[model samples]
Target chain A: MERMKMLEWVQALCFVVVDMELYLDTHPCDEEALAFYRDSVENYEKAKRKFEEMYGPLTAVKSMDCERWAWADVPLPWEGVR
Target chain B: MWTYERKLQYPVNITRPNPAMAKFIMSQYGGPDGEIAASMRYLSQRYSMDNKKVAGLLTDIGTEELAHMEMIAAIVRQLTKGCSAEELKESGLGEYYIDHTGAIWPQAAGGIPFNACEFQSKGDPLTDLFEDLAAEQKARTTYDNILRLVKDHEVADPIRFLRQREVVHFQRFGEGLRMYQEQLDSKNYYAFNPSFDK
Candidate 1:
């Protein structure tokens, strides 16, 4: 997949996790919701790892894997280049 | 506490640079009905909310507003990127250019700096939730106006998403209000401030 496309997929997966988190916050003991959230989190982590390896660090703390400070080199989220 | 998420809720990849559109969209970043105000209002109000569910709603929605704020900033930043100084000036962005130089700052389209006065944390759940409902509608209206002015699909797409969120938030706040009301004597729902008087 293209870099942007991969990044977007990671984004969509993460958003699902976040939205599920909000629902789970209100319904904390719902077993079905917990299962769904766990599944989404697993998928999101996989996608995030793929994107970070190919592109660059998505978070400041995750920049340790790069040989260089790729964080500074990557296009900012606001620049709309990534 | 909040975790730092590095992606926008929706994507904004504007291929064209339009400083004029950027100016207008900046309002959603810092205007009276902007995300900053929405986040501030809810986050602050949560401290005094009478019910756990209502407080949870405030906290979650407030956090989402922060994300929306970043989304608006992304849109404005992308819109203004790669524009010439002459084009910026002609687009009536000269005053803003002098200060921020295409860098995003929290300000309304008219250049008014973001102020806390734009929102309220009334402390009373009923009062605060009503304000929240009104705030969401006002924000939706602002987004509607933005949609009317913005023609770019890239820009409008995210704006539409943000606008839809306002509608959803309004419904949630409405439910929050109903929840709070149900806890009170129907004849005397306004009997006292549940946040303080108990």
Candidate 2:
């Protein structure tokens, strides 16, 4: 997949994960939602790893694989250079 | 405490430049009822919330507002991109251009810079939650005002999505308030400060 397209996929999955997290915070005992949330988190993690390997770090704290501090070098999302 | 996402919550691919529309829409970017204020209000108020669920709601919604802020910036940026000096001046953006020149600065359509005074984060949970409910409505009204002026489908589509989110957030905050009230004494809900009385 293209870099931008892959980035979008990762973003979409993360959105689902974040949304589910908000729901689960209110309904913490819902087993079904918890199952779905776990699945989405797994997918988001996989997609994030793939994008970071090809591109640069997504966040400064979790970019240990980066040889240098590439977080500051990459184009921001608003720059449309993904 | 937050993860980075490289795409907008809703996609914004504006194909035309409309500096005039950009100026109007810029109000939502940094206006009194803008997302920046929304985010700050909720995030700051959460520290005083005694209920975990209510605090979680504030944190999640507050985080979403940051994404909404980015979306508004994207819309303004795309609209102003490639606009010429003559077009900007003709569109009544010359005063803004003289200061920022197409760069995205947080300000209202009338050129009021963003100020924390636009929002309140009173330490009292009841007061803050009510303030939040009112803030969401104000933002919804602002989006409605923007929709009245924006003609482009690209611009209106995302604005509609944002307006819907405001309504949803209003409902959630309402639920949070009810939940907090239910935990209070049946005789007098306001008898004590749940946050401080413990």
Candidate 3:
């Protein structure tokens, strides 16, 4: 849980840098920056997916299974270390 | 599902600590229309979004807001790092020092606590999307305000990155609105639907 929290913090930072660049590429279409942003996003997505696979959903709507909508079982990070 | 990570995706090496500058930036952490509110607003709104593309956009942007929240926290952490009690007292961070003691807590510059009142999730797709659009601009304006007050390069770099995102989100919302309108029109938008009053 501690490890997850720490990586989540770092990923938060990386997410912004990569996302802002991607936003630029969507319109400006700078090939180099777009390429970099795409790579960064893929890396972040992999990290995020892996983290969620282990930790559960970060937001209520973003749960692993959208249909079942399971939010009760998972203990939030702020609630406990386990 | 979201989980917090331990390591920084990109290292933010704060060569020099500036607590005052950190305070100004701290507003975004808790201030109305700030990152905490932005993230909560969009993420919650995603639940009501029936359309896949719009939901995807909300997920992407809302997740991004989580990052902005972290960026603000990181700035606060780096600025307060290694500061002595006396330095903190002298730097006007004494108020924050008393409460958090170098820990990052979300609050506006005037010290207003974080509140959901800063944002909304109306459950109606158009209303929520428009709210998201407005929220993005509000954040962009707040970033502009932050840029005006901040001088440190380490802080400014990330602030600029966040500011640009607001623009991007606005653009996405604009696109989302058009798509949403098209979807509505499939039922014949010429009916003069009163539901559009929102």
Tens-place lDDT per residue, model 3, A1-82, is 4555655554664665656553552334467776766777777677666665665654565565645665655543321221
Worst ten-residue run, lDDT, model 2 chain A? A73-82
DockQ comparisons of all candidates to the true complex: 0.48, 0.35, 0.09
Model 2 earns a TM-score of 0.88
lDDT of 3: 0.72
Model 2 segments more than 4 A misplaced:
A61-63, A66-69, B1-6
If the candidates were sorted by their DockQ against the true structure, best first, what order would they fall in? 1, 2, 3
TM-score of each: 0.90, 0.88, 0.69
Sorted by lDDT, highest first, which candidate order results? 1, 2, 3
- For model 2, the docking class works out as acceptable
How would the candidate models be sorted by TM-score, starting from the highest?
Answer: 1, 2, 3
Error of 2 at B129 (Å): 1.2
Supply the global lDDT for candidate 2: 0.86
List the pairs of residues colliding in candidate 2: none
> Which of 1 and 2 is ahead in DockQ?
1
Candidate 2 i-RMS (Å)? 2.9
Across residues A1-82, which tens digit of lDDT does each residue of candidate 2 receive?
3877887788789878877877777678899999999999999999988888888777776557777777777666765531
Q: Which DockQ-derived CAPRI band holds candidate 3?
A: incorrect
- Model 3 off-target regions past 4 Å? A1-82, B3-11, B186-198
